[model samples]
Target: MNKSPGFILTQLGLDKDKVEKLVKALDPKTLQIAITDDFGSSFVLSTLSANIASIVETNVVLQHEKDGDLGNGWLETNYAGSRAFVLRSWKPNESDVLEANLTFWRGAPSIKRVVIRHVPEPATQRLLLEKGDVDMARNLSADQIAGLAGNKDTVVESSPKAEVYYDGLNQKHERLRNPKVRQALRWLVDYQGTTESFLEGRFKVHQAFWPSGFAGSSTETPFRLDVAKAKALLAEASYPNGFEVSLDASNFYPSIDVAQSVQATMAQSGIEVNIVPGEQKQVITKYRVRNHPMVFLYRSADYLDPHSNADTFTRNPDNSDKAKSRPLAWRNGREIPQFTEKTDAAARERDPAKRLQMYLELQKIVQENSPFVIVFQVQDQPARRANVKGFVTGPFADQIFYLLVQKRGSRDRGLAQPGSPILAGPDPGIRAVACDAPRASDPRHPRAHFLRAARGRLRDRPGGTDRPRPRDRG
Candidate 1:
């Protein structure tokens, strides 16, 4: 809705010239559509109309039919109470036919038809939409969102992902391990200006350590940006000069705001900084070593966890007990956190305030020693099809399954049974099951910002991130 109709025709994927040529074949007004996400395809899709056509959720093509251009799509199956859905794309095999996928929130996905696609990039996603393979995609960057300004027929919603973007501290370094240094870094960041300029007012600058709805996250006081205070902290740390560090980058992900701001602010104290942008995997490998030191990163929350977050970076990696069946982030081959070994006794305290206090104390200790610097806790955001309504945003800032989004022709596509499904975009009786899908591996994964000397442990996990990991604040 933020975009207009005339803009739809200019999109390259629509084959604008051909669409105009076939203007007589379709109703100009009925082809309208709307949706949101910060993915790359959104840039081009934003140019489409929303009057008659629209996309509800994100789609990724797994296997394709060479002859028909129809391929099998995927969704979260481990999620219980989720509806069955599929996007027609590549038909790699006959088995793909009659394949169905469930969208519940938790459990292992027992997919019958849909394939799970972990590394979804914009280029391939854009190609799928332009070819009429899917009606919609999710998430686009500020630049990508602006590019869709010309597309009139499609509705584009550039919702920021429910996560915080901040510079994490490296706990391993004795000097930076100091809270003064971490506090100074926080003061140096121009949170509001940078987020607004980069995310176009879609992102939230969290004032609290934990985002809303998490166990330990609280809405207490806020952290303001203050360069003057930052200078004082540097002086207190005896670092008239800033520390020297190599901001290993994945060429695609590492945000310019993070690198440039960090570089400039530290320079004020005489600390020199270097930047090394390369393939994500190699850079991540180089970064985790005790010898390879990185100071901070721009990050947002990946999941809702107050206690287990440090398990990845601080927990002794060799420890056998695991929250996730596989080796987690920050833990790959290294040692696990000391806290993970000790169970939280607060849960048995039975006193609400006492438990809250205990968790707060634990969080404080983690903050004191951990290399991760949490900026703000964010909220979850999930989008759906306009026609396939009955969707609602939640207090929690992450994706949830189980709610039904009824598409206009989904019955034909074998989604709903028809005869008036949920079409209103509000939380409708949908139950949320927490899906603990393992974080799929990507070679370009930005884990290097946290765990080094542990990359080899990840070899058992096979995967790589999309081209640049546009959101790799780490």
Candidate 2:
């Protein structure tokens, strides 16, 4: 039950030397310090604070309070972009936070500059790639990626069960409170159709609160499309007019295809769903704050631990901004506890069969009373570039938090093999290498030298002389 805090990080390619060097450079007492500027400090510390906020609710005392700040939050950001973000730190006294944010504009070459354009639709993204407009655009249906894969320029990488896509059953609704309604909705999803039509045969419907590999995950496919059974369940529950509910996620991951599909598919089960499509912010407001929507779609985590993301339904049931559930109106009288106590028992509970038993029970309870319906686990994108070298993938590839090494092409600096010494920084002579290639000293970091070359840390693409496509990326 002893797990390393950075197991995921190392597994994602920040292994050993690179991780050690980066941590040494980033840590205060360590020799190599990346930046000391206010903006950089803000960016780094703020991210840390946000992470802290997510994991453990603790006091985050930061250093400065920059009032009226504005900046752009993008895939690869810089000092200029910091101008676009308005930051509110967890604490107004931590200097490290400032250093991390402004790491972009320190006049040093960065590790990489990833371009993220909100394609929002798979077909358009495919079209853009076919036209050479994007280096990478996400949320494509599995089929779209398959079609794109036929082309040399585009590639698709996804997770088997990276995240769960599910329908939510509001705890407040009277009939929904009954386990029958929630369990019935599970039987209504066309998992095969989704795999064929949306995912393009790239995904499978997953049951259990967690996916197959996690500590408490199960490989059982409990729910399948059975409209007849669903109908019978509804009839037993009484009134087949089907409950009126609003489907919150009306937009698509890559396109409106997924949302529209959900809308049409759910209607097949006789549920009267009012399709509502709007800005995600507005929809989130309605779901979390206003409590106006009965069903909100959620795709949550299944990594590090199964209990990691399960608390959202168990705790954040109330839309109240103060982060507390309202008093219960049930026969039990008292309000249900927002958060079940998480302990060593919960995190490292050893018995797989026994733990899975507990997890199954939780799944049943959640389905019966929560506002989440677990759907098929999804695939995610990884760090892929044209001719880029020295990059590795990790379990967290589905989660972007690790280092990706990039080197200019062979002529850029006569690149060495992985684990080889960095002899002279990036220039036209550097050779680019990929993670899939033989061992080469990773150029995107502070490598020990023959002359010890310094890459942009993430700056230049692999072969710089012939720039790939300088097209205005979205």
Candidate 3:
């Protein structure tokens, strides 16, 4: 298993000897694994359920082996699981057609076929949805969503995603290294203003690393656009006249708008923010190397556990350039040894309540003092035909499932009143036409079909530009 190029032993947080002793295959269908560390049950269990741990058909994988290693062809070219839908056809940068898996163990999905079309333009998606050419539109701007307010033919569903948008103050910059400066920057953000304006219906004011709808999430938005307070803090930090710094941001919708809004607000406190707009990859690449003065970016959890975010946002185990694990804290050149210790302790707390408290405490510390000024949490708002029933959108893109989705006839479409819940109980045998954002280059699981569709449409752009779109993981 370790011969694969994608294999990473460090991801398990164990050395070779420990891994050999802890993992064993007892039978063809059963694998026994044990963690020697005092990790929380929730954290450990969550890791086991993550996409990386998904079981694959060993024989099918071995069939595509090359150079004594299993290649990545299974990710997109082969199907091995008994999922509800199987990829019938996939056209790059275009669409995917999934046929129902009749032999699925859980029972065949009521919908016979699921067709996902890649429609990048929100207006085109909206027009198609409105014309009944498509049953669902996964990408729509806040204004577009607002325009459909009273449309009885459609229902808008909003799900709070785990992604959080924040501004990272590069500690490599002398002015941004000060705690008071970090706090000052926090006060300079017009959270409500942005949330109500360009960010409306898409993001909500959030101040912590852990997003809401999770166990350890903090709902306290303590800092607002307090220019006077920010100025006082900056003055106390020996910068009577705020220092000039470059703020790198993705040159895209909402990000550019957000950067401009932040630029305007920071000016009120004497902080001269020179907006450096670039492609999302350019901005992220610069931030990843700790080369930016400040960066506006977003991060999503790899898994559902609180530590998924805490580990990245708070912990910086190594500060040197040679460090192998460089999370968000390292990306901003922030050394947080104390918070890292607390985060480790939180991850080890097996008691659910104690672990929750530990995470909460950690969040409070980061919220008040860290270089990261977490501003907002994403809210996914997808508009679907009023008759589209049983469609589900979860906190993460991978969690979205269309197994039970059904497209009722036009006669039944009028049965749904305006603003009524669109996600209803399942009715048998109907086809669904879903318009999604873009497509992920490497799709991992069969269930990830709709996820890739939703994720592609929401997170990335076509033609491999790497520009930041409206939503999804970092």
Candidate 4:
């Protein structure tokens, strides 16, 4: 089975026979895999590592289950996984309902039901959140976020997303092909000014491809708005008069604003920039084909690994238009052989500390030289009613989990009162079992007591009381 051409061994560039011999099924619940190559650690962090790591949920079906392009309809008709919630109903462009998974392995979710409504208008979303008709409002503009400041009933939660916004200078353009010109464009970006104004609270100045808060991320901001320096570099690149170029940007907030800012700054150094704004899809379609001279865009990592961003931003194995592997570097027509070699080596490094150091060095090299001018990392700000608690939004939007989320009031009142059940529903029988299990102060809380006992801090006395055990002073 491992030797079959359809197997993933070919994709990983591994010897199928070796891998097959190293993997064995010991029992129904136990499978062992031995890694013989340095690529093992990095591969484990990727989405292709395991079924659970895949972006799509892993489902158990008959040997020969559904076939032929299911496309987007797969999730609509099928149910899978042992998640806290199960899809109850879905209506295209309208709303979706998620019912609590009563038989979930962990426990039934606190919320009995979750209804997600599609309200595209930010104003409408704000109104619904303020009126207590909705528990949370996800898509809101900078102005809308500020407007909700005085709403005591609603509180905004902010989290730093792993998405980074940047300007990709296409090497296909003759003028942009110069390394000095590319470096000069970096200085033209007013990172401080942009983040301070329209992009305030929404984005932070992040110069590196790998976003901050990651293990090997670099928070270095070397380039600023230096017009004289940019002009000198343009002169060195044999473009003393500064050449004219077209920039493709999405006709929406932030992208258009950033493009206009770039345009204004580039003009200071005698560069003429013509802004061509189009719909998001149209702009991205052009960008993907390397048809744009320059593009203003944002990218989020596919997985939580330093190699994720490094591979996309630095490694371009093939610069040809027909290249099978097209990452961000390929799309920008950048042929970075040195960066590619370093990125691959970093991914394969066995030691955690050494791998992290390699990534930090790679980020510095890309930050100073690459055609991509990484500007800001996005901050997701979602407003929710005060009654809603334990709502978690991870670095990625898809990482949002509602397992522990709870409403602290009666269903009809929409107001939280002290001593109310964590979640309220019409059927009191379906109340959260975990909530009624134990209090933190109760001696019977097994988890708390076990944790303390594990640290040798707590011991049971003869009278059934927990007392702190004496430390071993010796």
The candidate maximizing lDDT is 3
Candidate ranking under lDDT, highest first, comes to 3, 4, 2, 1
Ten residues in sequence with the least summed lDDT for candidate 3? 412-421
Model 3 lDDT at residue 169:
85
Query: What is the clash tally of candidate 4?
Result: 0
lDDT of 2 by residue, 254-331 (tens): 224555665666677778777677666676556554354444444445244554444343433334345444321111
| C-alpha lDDT of all candidate models, in order | 0.39, 0.43, 0.73, 0.71
Off by over 4 Å in 1: 1-133, 146-166, 171-174, 207-209, 252-257, 295-305, 310-343, 347-354, 364-370, 376-385, 391-403, 409-474
Clashes of 2: 82
Q: lDDT tens string, model 3, 361-433?
A: 8889889888889999998887988778888866765565778887664221111111111112121111111
TM-score of each predicted structure versus truth: 0.50, 0.56, 0.82, 0.78
- Relative to the true structure, candidate 3 reaches a TM of 0.82
